[model samples]
Target: MKIGREDFEAFINGEKSITPYIETDLLAGSYSVFGVKTASNPNYLIKAIYEMYELNLNKKLAVKAVRNLFRSVGLGSVGLNNLLKKLGIDLKPSEFLMLVFKLQHQQGWGAPFELLEATDKRIILRTKQTFESQVMKDWNMQVCGIHQGWIEGVLMAVTGMNWFCLERTCHAKGDEFCEFVADQAESSWKFKAEAIVKGESAITEFIEHKPVEGTIKLIDDPVVIMPRFVFTSMMNSLKKTMGEMPAGGVNYRAYMDMGKENVEHYRKMGITKPHILADMAFTFYSQMGWFRIISMEWNEAKKEKTITLEHTVESEAFGNTGKNVCYCTAGLLAGIVEGSFGIKVQGREIRCRSKGDEHCVFAITNKPE
Candidate 1:
């Protein structure tokens, strides 16, 4: 079924029914998919990220970097394949790919998937609309890089070929639809090299080019912003680059710093109670489309707090991989508590959704004596 802005509005207003899978979570804050957490992200995030890249690099490289980032993190819709398997769609490669696309579409990844033509070596695909196009309609730039890279990754995984897809038309640029053409690459290395090369170039450009505004004032963060897919991809890239432990540590530290940065904001609002300040993040991030806070229990006498999150953004796209793939959020929760109380607090992920837990839970406590 097509979900329109009015539908979203009605759903938000409690005037319409929503999928049971996400009704409670959506009320609590955020969305979930097949027991995995997803987000109702805003369309502007694509533009915001594009702006970040554009400020440092040329538009071509900026777009390429975003595309490759998604490409490398491809086909991450976690538990859908298992569901598709029950339908006995595991035989034909093309059928497998199409089914995956269909499921992704249903999950709001994009519009319905239409396969225009398919050959042994090439395939052409089209979608009338995309989540990005809804916001980027007159931007004069093709902004559906996620679709381009996502299709390429899934094709490669299903066909065991180094598939590369190029966008021919994008609704973001006011086209009638978004179209992509995919073909096998000479080698997987050739297919993967683009991201690596462009990434290196982006790094150089980051240092050389003048940056855009460093910060912007906000009344409150947007309720829907970045996708869980992007969050998972970022964790994946860090894992690939720095190895799991270091990646988790670094990612944790960065977000902790980020959370601390909000100290002034909370102080300005005269929110001084650590528990209240720390509790506010759950709502803040929920509005930012991170995940739904399941439970928050605070123990004042012990100077500790524990949080359980049902919509695990960082782990939703990963299947039961048996790894602790979420940490940055833990740091965030802890950082806010520290800043709120102006005390040293440590955050730790006691349980992770990536490790097959039903929820991601963390704890913040006064630093050890």
Candidate 2:
């Protein structure tokens, strides 16, 4: 089906699913299966993986997740290879590499990644404006794991060879451009591959090397935000359809499950401290414009904590209905407390701005023995 701006808008509005819009046809080898657009915001994609990274604290797992995401994309690239075969473009190793570069640039992955050197055993590639570098500059770590996996996946799919892509330089590490080297030699690559598969930080070896200094203009990407009204409407609609059950039971269960998932995520990301986890949670929500954590107090002795969140737009938008309306927020807070503190805690929205209070207040207390 032909995708248009309306379809994209509908997708954003939660009125349509993206699956039907994905075009399987090779539109002039442009990877325009999603259609010809100048550029697309990757904030949602970045945020999802970043959240997973924060939750698991496992760099390798996060990297592997991104790699797997692209590996699925690489499966589609295999289909593209079949299309090229029919078009009389021979899938020579060099030609396939060029095809990868072309599709990468055409899809606006970077300002056109260039093949610096290619040999029988190794290949070198460079890009001045990689998507990961632009989006993850603040991360201060090599965030090109997706690209590494992607290159390996596509190459492997085409050549049927086990490939290893090492990111030698990353813009996230303050490099001017990103550089990657793909080696076909299994012996040289096996150690890092094994380490990554074992969920260990194999990226340390790549980042330890000095990066070359160069000058390149960075892309000024726009921040994307979900409309406040849309979010409120969705929440209100759920409340209306599900009735009191949603606020009292469903919301808690759903977000608590989300919390459990986040706990696993943060564990993988290697963050165990309650204070750090709480701070990270506040920052994560604040970045998404959920609410500002006005104050937080943790009592290690009592194993209890209180967090004051203010300017909750959700409550403000819906207004005071004479009941605690921030059920989802309350549930999320409960989950965070449980995950971070490693204890059963209940979050109660005792005060709400919707009910003529100064701000939404949540009291998190440990479950009694």
RMSD of each: 23.6, 16.8
Candidate 1, which ten residues in sequence have the lowest lDDT sum? Answer: 201-210
C-alpha-based local distance difference test score of model 1? 0.66
Q: Write the per-residue lDDT of candidate 1 for residues 1-369, one digit (tens) a residue.
A: 333445434433446544643433546785664345666555677778767777866666666667666765565632344444554434355555666565456566655778888887888888887776676555577777677777777776666677778888887787887888888876432223223333322322212222363433223221223455776688789889989899889989988888887764665655566655655555556545567788889889987788898766676767568977668788787777777778888998888888988899898888965
lDDT of 2 by residue, 1-369 (tens): 454446544543457654464454446543333453333446667767856765745554565557656655554568657755665556566557656655455455533567788877687888875777677677777777777777777777787777777788888888877888988755333344334334443232322222244322111112244577764676667768887655456766677668656655655555666766655555555535678789877778866667778877678677776666776677888887788778888888888887778878887787886
TM-score of each: 0.44, 0.42
Global fold similarity of model 1 (TM-score) = 0.44
Scored against the true structure, residue 93 in model 2 reaches a CA lDDT of 61
> Which ten residues in a row are the worst by lDDT in model 2?
214-223
Q: How close is candidate 2 to the true structure, as a TM-score?
A: 0.42
